[model samples]
Target: MALFSIQDICKSYPGVQAAQNVSFEIDEGEIVGFLGKNGAGKSTIIRILAGVEQPDSGTISMYEAPCTFTMAKQAADAGIAVVHQELNDVPLLTVAENMAMGLGYPKKAGILDRRALNARARAALAELHMDVDPNALVGELSVAERRMVMIARALLTDAKLIVLDEPTASLTEREIEELFAVIKRLKSQDVSFLYVSHRLKEITELCDRSLVMRDGHLVADVQMKEIDEDALVALIAGKRKESLTSKRAERTFGDEVLRVEGLDPFYRGSPFDLHVAAGEILGLAGLGGAGRTETIRQILGANPNLGVTCTLNGRNVQITSPKQAWDCGIGLVPEDRRNEGALLNFPITHNITLSSLKLRRSRNWLPFPSTGKEAREAEHQITTLNLKTPSAEESLANLSGGNQQKAILARSLSAGCKVLILDEPTHGVDVDAKTEIYSQIMRLAASGCAIILISSELPELIELADRFMVLSEGKLVASLNGEVSENELLKLCLTANSEMVA
Candidate 1:
């Protein structure tokens, strides 16, 4: 008998059939991959299992016994724990305090025993090979360390099954390896995991078997040993995928469209200097803490104290704020789309036209938004970006992660930007959406937009970037053109020497 199993699960929201007739099973001591596109019912099933949402019709069985849990506490009592992609820890609290929530604090003589609580938290962290101080504030911990604390908290509840949703989304390569090590250690002690991620490489490395979903239906189930990454992507996408390759035709770039100099104090090293030509796609490659994001922030005026000098179209320009950057024709599709890019509560049309509302005004004297013009532009963007939404008036929160990202991209383009900076544009999106986004980016570059692409996925950068600039310790260390290998990029990112690569 399976340790946990669900059958014929169905769920729906107004104007959306979120999930229908979904079924899967996880055996004891098994790590099962829950693979799907952004809106393909994976989240619904996870929520149902965690007791955060009730399925319209379904039966869940644990240890061969039928079980029904209607609330999160009930699910926890039944030995189910879920660690979400967006962490649910109180930043102001210490690690021990966060872990002790809902479990009661240690007490001695009717007084809170802080030492005992810290001891317990320390032991729990040690069990997962996590070296963290229990008294440290949760906010002070790195993303990776905080994730480990979440898992440790789940273990405190004696959970037999745990679900990890995109657990490595914010982790660096070294941090990811450490997480895998912890997962392996826990699996040895018979902890079953339901791992959900858009990254095929993680699933391939960690999961024993994978269940693929499409259109709210279970499409395929395959063992890890029997499937490759391409086959898994094909299963989730519901079609065979061609290779991801750049379709850029050989063309000469025009004069430099954007230039930066003296953006010091960005990371801890030398001053920066860079230039991007019109119709050129320049790729920035680095590991976490390598200053790729800081570089972009400096360019966009997020780091005003950096004293950077910028030039746009051969004219010196001073960008002291994000609004200034926007007015100067520099549009940035930020790294964190949900938090920084899109307004989740707003409608898709609103988000699409938010950065360029001035252009949609009826007249200069009495400035009022032209609803007709806004609708027309939103519809055009929706079609062009292939955004999956019922209508432009639909709430952005209701759309899948991929659609939200596309809407954000639409916002950048709608602003009439001459220089586009896409920071992890395809971070949380699926394989099909990634292909579409790459195509759109190539099209943008072909149309004379200077593009700067920064991605942690080296393969993506290698494919799309015309030239690569590698950053280490906040300094430009190497510049390479032509075909580049992931190994070469990794070496450049890890090395401390500031050697130039021609």
Candidate 2:
């Protein structure tokens, strides 16, 4: 008998059919990879299975016994746990306190048992070989550590089935290795897993079997050994994607549009310099935590005390805030779009026009906004970006991940900035969406937008950038012009990391 299963689950919202007859099962100790394009109904079905959402139709079975989950707690009580992509945690609380949430704190004679609570948290962390202080504040933990903490908290429930959504979105290579090790170890102990990720390589590495979702339907179920990454990508996209590279033959750049000098992205690290000309894409290449995003932040006015000099269009400027950065004709599409860049619950029109509201206002100081103007511009951007949505008034959260990203990009584009910084722009989208985004980026650069693109995928950089800058430990390790290979970039990063550690 299967350890857990959901049969013929169906869910709908407004005009969106989130899940249409989705059915799947996990055997004891099996690791299943869930693959789909954005808005293909992968997450919707997962939510139903994990009790985060109630299916309009369908049934769940555990050990061949029918069951229902109207609330998340009911699923938890049934030994099921879900770790969402965007973590929901209280930063002010300590690691132990955060882990103890929902689950009651340890107590003795009606008094909280702090030692026992810490011990329990420590034990859960130890399961993943995480060396974190249980009493340490969650706010101070790195993203990688915070993810591990969430996983640890889930395990505390003695979960029989675990659902992980984009578990490695922002993790370093080493952190990913540790996580996979823990997953394998847990699987050996008879723990079942449903893993969701856009990176097909990770699916190839860890998943025993794969399930593909398309248009809110369960499309295919195949053993991992029987399918290659290319075939898997094709199955998810419903079509093969050409190489994600610009089709332009030659590129021409104008005068220098943005430059940074003597900026230190890392604490007490050597200062570095960077510049981007109009109509150029400068790719910043590095492994996770190699200061690519940090460097971009510094240029956008992080750590002003470091005496970093930022020059735009040949004039020196002091930018201390994101608002100021925009005022100076600079824009950033942040890596963490959900938290930093997107307004999920709002309408697409609002999100698309948010950064450029000044353009819609009758006057700079006027509270009155031109809704008609905003909608027109939003529609224009939507059509230009090929964003798939019923209308501009549709709520952003209702759209797929790729469309949400498109809305964010539209926000940046409408802002009419000269220098644009894109951090991990294609992090968690399908091949089709990624290709669309790449084409839009190329078009933007052709229209004279100076671009600084940061991507973990070396092939993206090799194909997109006119030149690439490599940073390691916050230092400029290499500046490669002309052609470069993915292996070369990876080797440089690994070798630089080893040398620095030594």
Output the number of the lDDT-best candidate. Answer: 2
What does candidate 2's lDDT look like per residue over 391-438, in tens digits? 889999888766787788779867777999988787767677777778
For model 1, residues 177-251, the per-residue Cα lDDT tens digits are 767887787789888999988888899999999998887888988999999888888898788878765566786
Segments of candidate 2 deviating more than 4 angstroms: 122-133, 140-144, 246-248, 358-373, 383-386, 497-502
Global lDDT scores for all candidate models? 0.83, 0.84
> Which candidate tops TM-score?
2
Residue 21 of model 1, lDDT score: 85
Model 2 Cα displacement at 428 (Å)?
A: 2.1
State the lDDT at 201 in candidate 1.
Answer: 88
